[model samples]
Target: MVVAVIADIVGSRRLRDRAAAQRMFDETIARVQREHPLADQPLQPTVGDEQQGVYSTLDDALAGVLLLQLALPEGIEFRYGLGIGEIRAIESAHRELTDGPGWWAAREAIETVHARQERAVPTARSWIVAAPGQDEGMESRVSTSNAYLLARDAIVVRMTERERRLAYGRIGGLSQSALAEQEGITQPAVSKALRSSGAAALLDGLALMTGERS
Candidate 1:
Protein backbone atom coordinates (compact mmCIF):
# COMPACT_ATOMS: atom_id res chain seq x y z
CA MET A 1 0.00 0.00 0.00
CA VAL A 2 1.12 3.56 -0.66
CA VAL A 3 1.15 5.60 2.54
CA ALA A 4 2.16 9.17 3.39
CA VAL A 5 2.56 10.88 6.76
CA ILE A 6 2.45 14.46 8.07
CA ALA A 7 3.35 15.59 11.61
CA ASP A 8 3.91 18.93 13.32
CA ILE A 9 4.15 20.89 16.54
CA VAL A 10 0.86 21.88 18.12
CA GLY A 11 1.41 25.46 19.49
CA SER A 12 4.77 26.69 18.27
CA ARG A 13 4.33 30.44 18.66
CA ARG A 14 3.64 30.15 22.39
CA LEU A 15 6.92 28.29 22.61
CA ARG A 16 8.50 31.83 22.64
CA ASP A 17 11.96 30.53 21.94
CA ARG A 18 12.84 29.71 18.35
CA ALA A 19 16.04 27.89 19.28
CA ALA A 20 14.25 25.57 21.64
CA ALA A 21 11.48 24.99 19.13
CA GLN A 22 14.06 24.07 16.50
CA ARG A 23 15.67 21.66 18.91
CA MET A 24 12.32 20.06 19.56
CA PHE A 25 11.75 19.80 15.84
CA ASP A 26 15.14 18.25 15.29
CA GLU A 27 14.67 15.79 18.10
CA THR A 28 11.24 14.89 16.84
CA ILE A 29 12.72 14.20 13.41
CA ALA A 30 15.44 12.03 14.92
CA ARG A 31 12.93 10.11 16.97
CA VAL A 32 10.82 9.43 13.89
CA GLN A 33 13.84 8.32 11.92
CA ARG A 34 14.70 5.82 14.64
CA GLU A 35 11.37 4.10 14.07
CA HIS A 36 11.57 1.00 11.84
CA PRO A 37 10.97 1.08 8.09
CA LEU A 38 10.62 4.86 8.25
CA ALA A 39 14.27 5.18 9.29
CA ASP A 40 15.08 5.81 5.63
CA GLN A 41 11.86 7.53 4.71
CA PRO A 42 12.48 10.83 2.96
CA LEU A 43 11.26 13.73 5.11
CA GLN A 44 10.21 16.86 3.27
CA PRO A 45 9.72 20.09 5.17
CA THR A 46 6.44 21.82 4.56
CA VAL A 47 5.61 25.49 4.83
CA GLY A 48 4.37 26.92 8.10
CA ASP A 49 4.07 24.19 10.76
CA GLU A 50 4.37 20.67 9.35
CA GLN A 51 6.51 18.00 7.67
CA GLN A 52 5.70 15.14 5.30
CA GLY A 53 7.06 11.74 4.30
CA VAL A 54 6.01 8.61 2.43
CA TYR A 55 5.86 4.99 3.52
CA SER A 56 5.21 1.79 1.65
CA THR A 57 2.71 0.34 4.11
CA LEU A 58 -0.03 1.43 6.51
CA ASP A 59 1.57 -0.34 9.47
CA ASP A 60 4.85 1.53 9.17
CA ALA A 61 3.18 4.89 8.46
CA LEU A 62 0.80 4.65 11.39
CA ALA A 63 3.53 3.47 13.76
CA GLY A 64 5.76 6.36 12.72
CA VAL A 65 3.06 8.96 13.38
CA LEU A 66 2.24 7.50 16.79
CA LEU A 67 5.90 7.47 17.76
CA LEU A 68 6.28 11.12 16.82
CA GLN A 69 3.25 12.01 18.91
CA LEU A 70 4.58 10.24 21.97
CA ALA A 71 8.12 11.56 21.56
CA LEU A 72 7.07 15.19 21.32
CA PRO A 73 7.95 17.48 24.23
CA GLU A 74 5.21 18.16 26.74
CA GLY A 75 2.23 20.07 25.34
CA ILE A 76 2.78 18.86 21.78
CA GLU A 77 0.65 16.35 19.86
CA PHE A 78 0.40 15.03 16.28
CA ARG A 79 -2.32 14.34 13.69
CA TYR A 80 -1.67 11.96 10.79
CA GLY A 81 -3.11 11.21 7.33
CA LEU A 82 -2.63 7.92 5.45
CA GLY A 83 -3.57 6.99 1.89
CA ILE A 84 -3.24 3.64 0.09
CA GLY A 85 -2.98 3.36 -3.68
CA GLU A 86 -0.82 2.57 -6.67
CA ILE A 87 2.58 4.21 -7.09
CA ARG A 88 3.83 4.31 -10.66
CA ALA A 89 7.50 4.94 -11.18
CA ILE A 90 8.09 7.43 -13.99
CA GLU A 91 11.70 6.49 -14.67
CA SER A 92 13.01 3.43 -12.89
CA ALA A 93 16.57 4.70 -13.33
CA HIS A 94 15.89 8.02 -11.58
CA ARG A 95 13.31 6.51 -9.17
CA GLU A 96 10.82 9.38 -9.57
CA LEU A 97 7.09 8.80 -9.26
CA THR A 98 4.01 10.82 -10.22
CA ASP A 99 1.08 11.61 -7.98
CA GLY A 100 -1.92 9.33 -8.14
CA PRO A 101 -5.20 8.79 -6.31
CA GLY A 102 -3.31 7.58 -3.23
CA TRP A 103 -1.38 10.84 -3.04
CA TRP A 104 -4.60 12.84 -3.42
CA ALA A 105 -6.25 10.91 -0.62
CA ALA A 106 -3.34 11.49 1.74
CA ARG A 107 -3.40 15.22 1.02
CA GLU A 108 -7.14 15.26 1.67
CA ALA A 109 -6.66 13.55 5.04
CA ILE A 110 -4.11 16.19 6.13
CA GLU A 111 -6.32 18.98 4.82
CA THR A 112 -9.17 17.52 6.79
CA VAL A 113 -7.12 17.82 9.99
CA HIS A 114 -5.78 21.24 9.00
CA ALA A 115 -9.32 22.53 8.52
CA ARG A 116 -10.30 20.96 11.83
CA GLN A 117 -7.24 22.42 13.61
CA GLU A 118 -8.20 25.91 12.40
CA ARG A 119 -11.43 25.53 14.37
CA ALA A 120 -9.52 24.94 17.62
CA VAL A 121 -10.95 21.46 18.05
CA PRO A 122 -8.28 19.93 20.26
CA THR A 123 -6.88 16.44 19.67
CA ALA A 124 -8.76 15.84 16.44
CA ARG A 125 -7.58 13.12 14.04
CA SER A 126 -8.87 11.56 10.78
CA TRP A 127 -8.11 8.79 8.29
CA ILE A 128 -9.06 8.46 4.61
CA VAL A 129 -8.91 5.38 2.40
CA ALA A 130 -8.80 5.20 -1.42
CA ALA A 131 -8.98 1.78 -2.98
CA PRO A 132 -11.20 1.56 -6.05
CA GLY A 133 -11.27 -2.20 -5.82
CA GLN A 134 -11.94 -3.40 -2.31
CA ASP A 135 -9.76 -6.14 -0.91
CA GLU A 136 -9.21 -7.64 2.52
CA GLY A 137 -6.31 -5.28 3.19
CA MET A 138 -8.37 -2.26 2.18
CA GLU A 139 -11.19 -3.43 4.39
CA SER A 140 -8.79 -3.76 7.31
CA ARG A 141 -7.44 -0.25 6.79
CA VAL A 142 -10.98 1.14 6.82
CA SER A 143 -11.79 -0.66 10.04
CA THR A 144 -8.60 0.55 11.71
CA SER A 145 -9.26 4.10 10.57
CA ASN A 146 -12.72 4.07 12.14
CA ALA A 147 -11.33 2.79 15.41
CA TYR A 148 -8.61 5.46 15.44
CA LEU A 149 -11.17 8.22 14.87
CA LEU A 150 -13.34 7.01 17.72
CA ALA A 151 -10.50 6.84 20.22
CA ARG A 152 -9.16 10.21 19.09
CA ASP A 153 -12.58 11.81 19.59
CA ALA A 154 -12.81 10.40 23.09
CA ILE A 155 -9.47 11.97 24.05
CA VAL A 156 -10.44 15.28 22.48
CA VAL A 157 -13.72 15.39 24.37
CA ARG A 158 -12.05 14.85 27.72
CA MET A 159 -9.48 17.55 26.98
CA THR A 160 -12.29 19.91 25.97
CA GLU A 161 -13.99 19.65 29.34
CA ARG A 162 -10.74 20.45 31.11
CA GLU A 163 -10.17 23.47 28.88
CA ARG A 164 -13.70 24.72 29.50
CA ARG A 165 -13.02 24.82 33.22
CA LEU A 166 -9.83 26.73 32.67
CA ALA A 167 -11.53 29.16 30.31
CA TYR A 168 -14.27 29.75 32.82
CA GLY A 169 -11.71 30.56 35.46
CA ARG A 170 -9.96 33.07 33.23
CA ILE A 171 -13.21 34.64 32.13
CA GLY A 172 -14.61 34.92 35.65
CA GLY A 173 -11.28 36.27 36.94
CA LEU A 174 -11.27 33.70 39.69
CA SER A 175 -8.31 33.34 42.01
CA GLN A 176 -6.62 29.94 42.17
CA SER A 177 -8.24 29.17 45.51
CA ALA A 178 -11.67 30.28 44.36
CA LEU A 179 -11.50 28.29 41.14
CA ALA A 180 -10.22 25.24 42.99
CA GLU A 181 -13.09 25.47 45.45
CA GLN A 182 -15.57 25.94 42.61
CA GLU A 183 -14.24 22.96 40.67
CA GLY A 184 -13.53 20.82 43.73
CA ILE A 185 -9.89 20.47 42.65
CA THR A 186 -6.64 21.63 44.19
CA GLN A 187 -5.39 25.15 43.38
CA PRO A 188 -2.14 23.73 42.05
CA ALA A 189 -3.97 21.39 39.68
CA VAL A 190 -5.99 24.33 38.36
CA SER A 191 -2.86 26.38 37.75
CA LYS A 192 -1.03 23.48 36.20
CA ALA A 193 -3.73 22.57 33.69
CA LEU A 194 -4.26 26.16 32.56
CA ARG A 195 -0.57 26.83 32.10
CA SER A 196 0.13 23.55 30.28
CA SER A 197 0.48 23.39 26.51
CA GLY A 198 -2.22 20.74 26.33
CA ALA A 199 -4.65 23.58 26.97
CA ALA A 200 -3.20 25.39 23.95
CA ALA A 201 -3.78 22.20 21.96
CA LEU A 202 -7.36 22.39 23.08
CA LEU A 203 -7.52 25.90 21.64
CA ASP A 204 -6.01 24.57 18.43
CA GLY A 205 -8.69 21.92 18.35
CA LEU A 206 -11.24 24.66 18.95
CA ALA A 207 -9.80 26.58 16.03
CA LEU A 208 -10.31 23.46 13.93
CA MET A 209 -13.94 23.16 14.95
CA THR A 210 -14.65 26.88 14.54
CA GLY A 211 -12.78 27.39 11.25
CA GLU A 212 -10.20 29.78 12.67
CA ARG A 213 -6.67 30.04 11.26
CA SER A 214 -4.05 28.03 13.20
Candidate 2:
Protein backbone atom coordinates (compact mmCIF):
# COMPACT_ATOMS: atom_id res chain seq x y z
CA MET A 1 0.00 0.00 0.00
CA VAL A 2 1.15 3.52 -0.72
CA VAL A 3 0.74 6.28 1.82
CA ALA A 4 -0.21 9.77 0.69
CA VAL A 5 0.48 12.84 2.82
CA ILE A 6 -1.21 16.18 2.32
CA ALA A 7 -0.58 19.16 4.55
CA ASP A 8 -1.24 22.87 4.68
CA ILE A 9 -0.26 25.71 6.92
CA VAL A 10 -2.59 26.33 9.84
CA GLY A 11 -4.08 29.84 10.15
CA SER A 12 -2.17 30.83 7.04
CA ARG A 13 -4.78 33.38 6.03
CA ARG A 14 -4.37 35.23 9.29
CA LEU A 15 -0.72 35.92 8.76
CA ARG A 16 0.11 39.58 8.38
CA ASP A 17 2.60 38.83 5.64
CA ARG A 18 1.26 36.21 3.27
CA ALA A 19 4.32 36.28 1.03
CA ALA A 20 6.70 35.46 3.90
CA ALA A 21 4.53 32.58 5.00
CA GLN A 22 4.47 31.18 1.47
CA ARG A 23 8.23 31.43 1.26
CA MET A 24 8.60 29.62 4.54
CA PHE A 25 6.15 26.97 3.39
CA ASP A 26 8.14 26.44 0.23
CA GLU A 27 11.37 26.30 2.18
CA THR A 28 9.92 23.73 4.58
CA ILE A 29 8.88 21.52 1.64
CA ALA A 30 12.35 21.80 0.15
CA ARG A 31 13.94 20.88 3.47
CA VAL A 32 11.71 17.84 3.86
CA GLN A 33 12.54 16.72 0.32
CA ARG A 34 16.24 17.11 1.00
CA GLU A 35 16.11 15.36 4.36
CA HIS A 36 13.60 12.59 3.70
CA PRO A 37 14.98 10.32 1.00
CA LEU A 38 12.31 7.67 1.63
CA ALA A 39 9.49 9.74 0.13
CA ASP A 40 8.15 8.28 -3.14
CA GLN A 41 8.54 11.71 -4.64
CA PRO A 42 9.45 15.13 -3.32
CA LEU A 43 6.51 17.06 -1.94
CA GLN A 44 5.13 19.59 -4.39
CA PRO A 45 2.90 22.54 -3.80
CA THR A 46 -0.60 21.65 -4.93
CA VAL A 47 -2.93 24.61 -4.47
CA GLY A 48 -2.73 27.62 -2.19
CA ASP A 49 -0.77 26.64 0.92
CA GLU A 50 -1.24 22.88 0.52
CA GLN A 51 1.44 20.39 -0.47
CA GLN A 52 1.26 16.70 -1.36
CA GLY A 53 3.60 13.74 -1.53
CA VAL A 54 3.68 9.95 -1.41
CA TYR A 55 5.59 7.44 0.63
CA SER A 56 6.22 3.73 0.31
CA THR A 57 5.09 3.14 3.89
CA LEU A 58 2.97 4.82 6.52
CA ASP A 59 5.90 4.99 8.93
CA ASP A 60 8.05 6.90 6.47
CA ALA A 61 5.22 9.30 5.71
CA LEU A 62 4.62 10.00 9.38
CA ALA A 63 8.33 10.51 9.94
CA GLY A 64 8.50 12.95 7.06
CA VAL A 65 5.55 14.86 8.48
CA LEU A 66 7.19 15.13 11.86
CA LEU A 67 10.38 16.36 10.25
CA LEU A 68 8.53 19.00 8.32
CA GLN A 69 6.64 20.18 11.38
CA LEU A 70 9.78 20.48 13.44
CA ALA A 71 11.70 22.23 10.66
CA LEU A 72 9.23 25.09 10.38
CA PRO A 73 9.73 28.44 12.07
CA GLU A 74 8.29 29.17 15.50
CA GLY A 75 5.10 30.87 14.33
CA ILE A 76 4.32 28.36 11.59
CA GLU A 77 2.31 25.19 12.10
CA PHE A 78 0.75 22.65 9.74
CA ARG A 79 -2.07 20.15 9.68
CA TYR A 80 -1.46 16.76 8.08
CA GLY A 81 -3.69 14.17 6.44
CA LEU A 82 -2.41 10.68 5.72
CA GLY A 83 -4.16 8.11 3.54
CA ILE A 84 -3.17 4.58 2.65
CA GLY A 85 -4.17 3.01 -0.67
CA GLU A 86 -3.20 2.70 -4.31
CA ILE A 87 -2.07 5.78 -6.26
CA ARG A 88 -2.18 6.50 -9.98
CA ALA A 89 0.47 8.83 -11.35
CA ILE A 90 0.09 10.85 -14.53
CA GLU A 91 3.44 11.92 -15.89
CA SER A 92 3.85 15.16 -17.77
CA ALA A 93 6.80 17.09 -19.10
CA HIS A 94 6.80 19.53 -16.21
CA ARG A 95 5.70 17.43 -13.21
CA GLU A 96 4.14 14.15 -12.21
CA LEU A 97 0.52 14.45 -11.18
CA THR A 98 -1.18 11.94 -8.93
CA ASP A 99 -4.78 10.88 -8.43
CA GLY A 100 -6.83 7.91 -7.33
CA PRO A 101 -8.32 6.54 -4.13
CA GLY A 102 -5.22 7.45 -2.15
CA TRP A 103 -5.41 11.14 -2.95
CA TRP A 104 -9.15 11.17 -2.43
CA ALA A 105 -8.84 9.55 0.97
CA ALA A 106 -6.14 12.01 1.96
CA ARG A 107 -8.33 14.89 0.95
CA GLU A 108 -11.10 13.49 3.07
CA ALA A 109 -8.80 13.21 6.05
CA ILE A 110 -7.56 16.79 5.69
CA GLU A 111 -11.09 18.05 5.37
CA THR A 112 -11.95 16.14 8.52
CA VAL A 113 -9.16 17.96 10.36
CA HIS A 114 -10.36 21.27 9.04
CA ALA A 115 -13.86 20.55 10.28
CA ARG A 116 -12.51 19.60 13.68
CA GLN A 117 -10.57 22.84 13.83
CA GLU A 118 -13.67 24.81 12.95
CA ARG A 119 -15.46 23.14 15.83
CA ALA A 120 -12.57 24.01 18.18
CA VAL A 121 -11.39 20.49 18.78
CA PRO A 122 -8.26 20.43 20.89
CA THR A 123 -5.10 18.99 19.37
CA ALA A 124 -6.78 18.20 16.08
CA ARG A 125 -3.89 18.69 13.73
CA SER A 126 -3.17 15.34 12.12
CA TRP A 127 -5.48 12.64 10.84
CA ILE A 128 -5.50 9.38 8.87
CA VAL A 129 -8.06 7.73 6.63
CA ALA A 130 -7.66 4.37 4.95
CA ALA A 131 -9.05 3.86 1.49
CA PRO A 132 -12.28 1.86 1.39
CA GLY A 133 -11.95 -1.91 0.80
CA GLN A 134 -8.19 -1.66 0.79
CA ASP A 135 -8.00 -4.59 3.15
CA GLU A 136 -10.22 -6.72 5.32
CA GLY A 137 -8.56 -5.23 8.41
CA MET A 138 -8.69 -1.64 7.20
CA GLU A 139 -10.91 -0.54 10.04
CA SER A 140 -8.51 -1.74 12.71
CA ARG A 141 -5.54 -0.20 10.97
CA VAL A 142 -7.27 3.15 10.60
CA SER A 143 -8.24 3.19 14.24
CA THR A 144 -4.72 2.48 15.42
CA SER A 145 -3.18 5.01 13.03
CA ASN A 146 -5.54 7.78 14.04
CA ALA A 147 -5.04 7.00 17.70
CA TYR A 148 -1.30 7.34 17.23
CA LEU A 149 -1.58 10.65 15.42
CA LEU A 150 -3.97 12.04 17.99
CA ALA A 151 -1.68 11.28 20.90
CA ARG A 152 1.39 12.39 18.95
CA ASP A 153 -0.01 15.72 17.89
CA ALA A 154 -1.48 16.37 21.29
CA ILE A 155 1.92 16.15 22.91
CA VAL A 156 3.66 18.11 20.16
CA VAL A 157 1.18 20.95 20.26
CA ARG A 158 1.91 21.55 23.92
CA MET A 159 5.66 21.82 23.50
CA THR A 160 7.39 25.18 23.90
CA GLU A 161 9.66 26.40 21.12
CA ARG A 162 12.78 25.43 23.05
CA GLU A 163 11.32 22.02 23.77
CA ARG A 164 10.62 21.50 20.10
CA ARG A 165 14.18 22.47 19.25
CA LEU A 166 15.50 19.95 21.73
CA ALA A 167 13.19 17.26 20.43
CA TYR A 168 14.29 17.96 16.88
CA GLY A 169 17.93 17.78 17.83
CA ARG A 170 17.45 14.56 19.76
CA ILE A 171 15.56 12.96 16.88
CA GLY A 172 18.42 13.89 14.56
CA GLY A 173 20.77 11.81 16.74
CA LEU A 174 22.35 14.57 18.74
CA SER A 175 23.59 13.53 22.14
CA GLN A 176 22.52 15.46 25.23
CA SER A 177 25.99 16.93 25.57
CA ALA A 178 25.98 17.93 21.93
CA LEU A 179 22.59 19.53 22.26
CA ALA A 180 23.73 21.32 25.40
CA GLU A 181 26.68 22.74 23.54
CA GLN A 182 24.47 23.88 20.71
CA GLU A 183 22.01 25.49 23.11
CA GLY A 184 24.77 26.98 25.25
CA ILE A 185 23.49 25.23 28.32
CA THR A 186 24.88 22.64 30.67
CA GLN A 187 24.27 18.98 29.96
CA PRO A 188 22.29 18.66 33.16
CA ALA A 189 20.13 21.58 32.12
CA VAL A 190 19.50 19.99 28.78
CA SER A 191 18.47 16.79 30.53
CA LYS A 192 16.10 18.76 32.74
CA ALA A 193 14.58 20.50 29.74
CA LEU A 194 14.07 17.25 27.88
CA ARG A 195 12.46 15.63 30.86
CA SER A 196 10.25 18.58 31.71
CA SER A 197 9.19 19.16 28.12
CA GLY A 198 8.19 15.52 27.60
CA ALA A 199 10.78 15.01 24.91
CA ALA A 200 11.47 11.46 26.11
CA ALA A 201 7.80 10.63 25.77
CA LEU A 202 7.77 12.20 22.33
CA LEU A 203 10.75 10.05 21.32
CA ASP A 204 8.99 6.95 22.55
CA GLY A 205 5.90 7.93 20.60
CA LEU A 206 7.99 8.38 17.46
CA ALA A 207 9.50 4.94 17.95
CA LEU A 208 6.00 3.53 18.05
CA MET A 209 5.09 5.48 14.92
CA THR A 210 8.03 3.92 13.05
CA GLY A 211 7.23 0.46 14.42
CA GLU A 212 10.56 0.42 16.17
CA ARG A 213 8.84 -0.36 19.45
CA SER A 214 5.51 -1.59 20.68
Pick the TM-score winner: 2
Over the stretch 1-214, how does candidate 1's per-residue lDDT look in tens digits? 5776555555667777866676667776675575333533545556667666777766555545544444455555556666667645465665454566666677777777767757765446656566466598678756766465545444443454455456434433457788788888898888787656254353344334325322
* Candidate 1 TM-score versus the reference: 0.56
List the candidate 2 regions with Cα displacement exceeding 4 Å: 91-94
Q: Per model, how many backbone clashes are there? A: 18, 0
Per-residue lDDT over 84-173 for candidate 2, one digit per residue giving the tens place of the 0 to 100 score: 888887988997677888888899999998887678676788888888886667777678878777777777788877788788788778
Residue 138 accuracy (lDDT) in model 2: 70
Model 1 lDDT, full chain set: 0.58
TM-score of every candidate: 0.56, 0.91
Cα displacement (Å) at residue 170, model 1: 38
